[model samples]
Target: MASVTLSGLRKEYGDLTAVDGLDLDVDDGELLCLLGPSGCGKSTTLRMLGGLETPTDGDVHIGDEPVTDQPPYERNTSMVFQSWALFPRKSVIENVAFGLKMDGVSEDERRERAREMLDVVEMGEFVDHDPTDLSGGQKQRVALARSLAIEPDVLLLDEPLSNLDKRLREQMQLELRNIHDAVETTFVHVTHDQNEAFTLADSIAIMHDGDIEQIGAPREVYDDPVSLFIEEFLGDTNLVDATVAEVTETGVIADTAFDTEVDVRTGDAAVAQGDGLSVSFRPEELDVERVEGTDGDGASAVTGEITDVLYRGSTVRFYVDLGGEHLFFEQSVGADTAFSAGDVVRVSWDPDDLLAFAADGARVGRGET
Candidate 1:
């Protein structure tokens, strides 16, 4: 296993800059993911790492060696594409052994290594079956076996499970993690699926428009996104517009519409009074209840009418109209406290769970809230 690094890596097509000065490091034997939407240069970055596409500038390194100018064969890495790219006429064993055959490994050793790799992927029984007869998930497994048969320094995967159905994709995500752990090889996977990235990656670099917006573990990036794009991209959040009401030693307080005051913990960044700030909170952190007569918690509670309720099997999501702006919150639905639409609820969350961001939606400080 070897670590992969890209420094100031770029790829341009005339006027269009596909990958722009991207820098990242994949730890030796760790599975890292390059996650983002389409056209975000994830695929280009992967191809550059695999030597399938040369960078316009910067360097690519595997282990301690600079391989920016190396051809695909010279680079000690294997790539699995989205389309599987297996030869339909080749049997499973042939498909897996193809790379070794090209490398001029003896036929006996090639078939033996192919069978061993297939066993690792739990597809040894289908070694003699035709590739056309296999299902989508089986084909992907075959592709994975083929990539692993070469025993490269790093494995690059480009949405290798996108062609499968949802269930199969989920299953493959687990299988891929197991394979990564078992092989102990550096893996760099690219995908737009949040669940896939969160589950499979030890570290994730979330890219946007040819640049990495945030790079962290799944929980770190999800909880403390650095920019507006990240906040909206990772998951659902209620971004409330508010102004800094006061700055205290502990934290800064913001007052929003409908006389709702929020306490935002300032981690390290200092903010002054009247600073334009936005308070961000996850729906799961909120508690919604029927508001009673006066004397409610001044800083915590916000009186709002539940405009709609969506019962998602595990949780219930509520859309509350607080004055003109709508806020969303979620509750763990249980047998008791079963709620429905048109419920006038007071929404409140733990002060420790509130995340405060700049007006531009960039997180200011780091804390529970």
Candidate 2:
């Protein structure tokens, strides 16, 4: 296992800058994921690390060695691509043995290593089968076996699970993380899937438009997204424009966009009076309950008619129209949620779940999302 370092990494295509002066250090044996939407330079960054694309400016080092100018073959790194690039005519064992064969290993040793790698990926029974005969998931395992057969110092995965079905892709995510833990190789994975990064990475580097927006643990980045872009990109959130009314010892009080006052947790952020704020919270953080007798407990933060109820198998999504402002709320699967469109309901939420961000999208002391 080896640590990878990138400094001032840059890639340009004519007038467009794909990667703009990026600096990142991935620790040894850590599974680091470069996560972002398409056109965010995640794949480009991965290509540069794999030596497939030369950077316009900057350096890449694997451990103590400078490998900026080296070709892919000399970098001692293995890549598993989205297409599972296995030779159609080659058998499973043969494809896995190809890397070892290129490195000048004996035929017997190469086959032995190939079998071991196939077993590691749980594809040992398909050793004699051609790549064309394997299913999508099986082909993926073969590709992983081939990459692991080389005993690479670093393993680079470029959305290797993108081709699989939803269930199979989720299964592979766990298996891939387990494999990384067993081998302890420094793995750098690039994907636009936020859940993939949250599930597999030791640290996530959120990329946006050729730059890193925020990089941290999945929970940390999810809980305290620094800006509106980060808040919306990482996950689904309800964003409301509010004005900072008061900064209290526990949190901050704000006048919500819908003409309601609410207190929100301040995560060490500074807020000033009359500051335009954007409040963000996940759908799960807010709940809808039956509007029983008395209007006590400040239960009615906002009253709205149910505009829609989307049953999503494991959970149901309720869209409420609070006057002109609309927001969605989610709840776990239940047959007792006798809610439908046009039902009057009261929505309530814990103030601690709210995050505040400035109008310009910058984080104020504990405000802004």
Candidate 3:
């Protein structure tokens, strides 16, 4: 296993910059996931690490050696692509052994290593199956086996499970985590799927544009997002626009679009009256109760009429119309309260749970009491 590092990494195409000056470090035997939406330079960053793309500026290091100038084959890394680029003409084991064969290993040794990798990936029984006949999940396993057959120091995975069905992809996420544990190879996985990153990564680096926005364990980043982009990208939540009405010793009072003035616990956040703020109300943090009249009493509670009710597999989502603005909350389907459209309800939450962001997309307060 080897620790990987990137310093001042950059890549540009004519006038378009895919990767800006970015620096990152991957610990030995750690699984780090680069997570972001499309065109965020995550794949470009991964390619640079694997020596598949040369950085326009900056350096790449593996372990203690600088490898910016090294070619793909010269680096001790293997990449599993989204396409599962298997050889249609070769058997499963032959495909797995192909990399070793190219590296000048003897036929007997390469085949033995291939069998061992196949077993590690739980594909030992399909050594002789044709690649064309394999299912999507089976193909992905074979591709993984092929990459692992060479015993690379750092394994690069570029959306390797994106092609599988939802259930199969989820299953593969767990299996991949197990495989990483068994092999202990340094892994750098790139994906835009939030759940996948949460499942497989020892740490997640959220990318925006060409640089990393935030990096931490799954729950750490999710629970304490540093910016509005990070908060919005991590999951679904109700973002309401508001303006500061007054600043007090305890917190700030903000007039929200929900036709109510709410108290936000802004921990040492610099703000003044009339400043615009985007307040996040996460669905799970909200408490909802069916009400008859529009009058709701409390600084943290507001009365709204249910506009729509969506029945998800295990949870129900409700959209509420407060004045002219909309906010939503969710509840498990087995919950006792059964709300429908046109039902007036009171939506309330703790002031500390609200995360406020300024106009510049920076989080206003730490939300600490």
Candidate 4:
């Protein structure tokens, strides 16, 4: 296991910067995920680390050694692609042993090590079966076993479960986490799947337009995003316009665009009077009911008419019209009560649950709160 570091790492294609001045530190034995949409340079960053692509400038270091000049084989890092890339003619055991064989290990030791790795990946029973006869998940297991057999310093997985169906993909995610824990290698995975990143990553680096927008644990980044892009991108949230009305010792007070002034007290922020700002709160944070009054828990309330309702399995999504503006609220149905479309309701939430961001979409610093 090793810690990987990139300093001012850049990659360009003519005038376009595919990866711009990227800097990151992936701790030893940590599973760091490079998460972003397509064309955000996540794959390019992973490739640069694996020595598959060279950076236009800056350094790639493993431990204390700068490996920007080294080749993939010389860097001692093994990569698993989205494609399984198993040999069709080779059985699982043979495929697992292929790398060790090429590295000049004795045949007896190679088979022993390959068998052990297959067992780790829960594919020991299929050691003698041809990979062509295996299902997609089984083939991916074989590929994982093959990658593990080499005992590389770092393991790079690029959307390793993208080819599987939903159920299989979910199952493989746990399996992959198990493999990582068993081996304890530094894993850097790249994917666009939000839940995949949240489930598997120790820390996530959210990239946008060839730059990192935020890097934090799943809950931290989700609950307190640093930008409007980060807030909306992480999950579904309500972004309502508001203005700073007053400042208090506990937090700040703001007036919403809908003529409703509420005491949104929380921590300090870089806000001033009359400054235009935006408030973000998740749908699940709101309390919805059929009245315009507060639930008497110091909860701020916004009353509106339910314009639309969509059933989504366990929960229902409600579109509330606050005059001309629309607010989305997600309510989990229980035996206690239920709601439907065209119902006039009041949405209540605590002041602490409200997040403040600047009009320019950047997060207000907590120091100024």
Residue pairs in steric clash, candidate 1? Answer: 352-369, 353-369, 354-369, 355-369
Q: What is the per-residue lDDT of model 3 for residues 1-369, given as tens digits with 9 covering 90 to 100?
A: 899999999999899899999999999999999999999999999999999999999999999999999999999899999999999999999999998998999999998999999998889999999999999999999999999988899999999999999999999999999999999999999999999999999999999999999998999999889899999999999999999999987678999887689999886679999999999999989999988896784689988899999999999999999878988999889888989999999999998899899999998876465
Segments of candidate 4 deviating more than 4 angstroms: 245-252, 265-268, 292-299, 333-335, 367-369
Provide the clashing-pair count of each candidate structure.
4, 9, 0, 5
RMSD values, in order shown: 1.9, 2.3, 1.2, 2.5
Q: Pairing residues by index, what is the TM-score of model 3?
A: 0.97
Q: What are the TM-scores, per candidate, against the unseen true structure?
A: 0.94, 0.93, 0.97, 0.92
Off by over 4 Å in 2: 245-252, 267-271, 292-300, 366-369
Q: Which ten residues in a row have the lowest lDDT in candidate 1?
A: 291-300
Q: Which model, 2 or 4, shows the larger TM-score?
A: 2
Candidate 2 lDDT by residue in tens digits, 1-369 = 899999999999999999999999999999999999999999999999999999999999999999999999999999999999999888899999999999999999999999999999999899999899899999999999999899999999999999999899999999999999999899999988999899999999999889888888888888777778888888887888888788777667888876677887664476677888888857878877766432533512677788999998898888888667787888777758778888877888877777777888876654332
The prediction achieving the highest TM-score against the true structure is 3
Better of 1 and 2 by TM-score: 1
lDDT of 4 by residue, 1-369 (tens): 889999998999999899999999999999988999889999999999999999999899998889999998788788888888999888889999998998999999999999999998889899899999999999888888898889888899988899999899999888888888989999999989989999899999999988788998988787767888888877888888988888777667778876677666545665788988888867878877787443432328878788898888888888988788888987676736577777888878877777778888887654333
Write one digit per residue (lDDT tens) for candidate 1, span 59-142.
Answer: 999999999999999987999999999999899999999999999999999999999999998898999999998988999999
The positional error of residue 48 in candidate 3, measured at the CA in angstroms, is 0.6
Q: Give the 10-residue window scoring lowest on summed lDDT in candidate 4.
A: 290-299
Query: Candidate 4 at 248: error in angstroms?
Result: 4.9
**Cα error, candidate 2, residue 103 (Å):** 0.7
Error of 2 at 308 (Å): 1.1
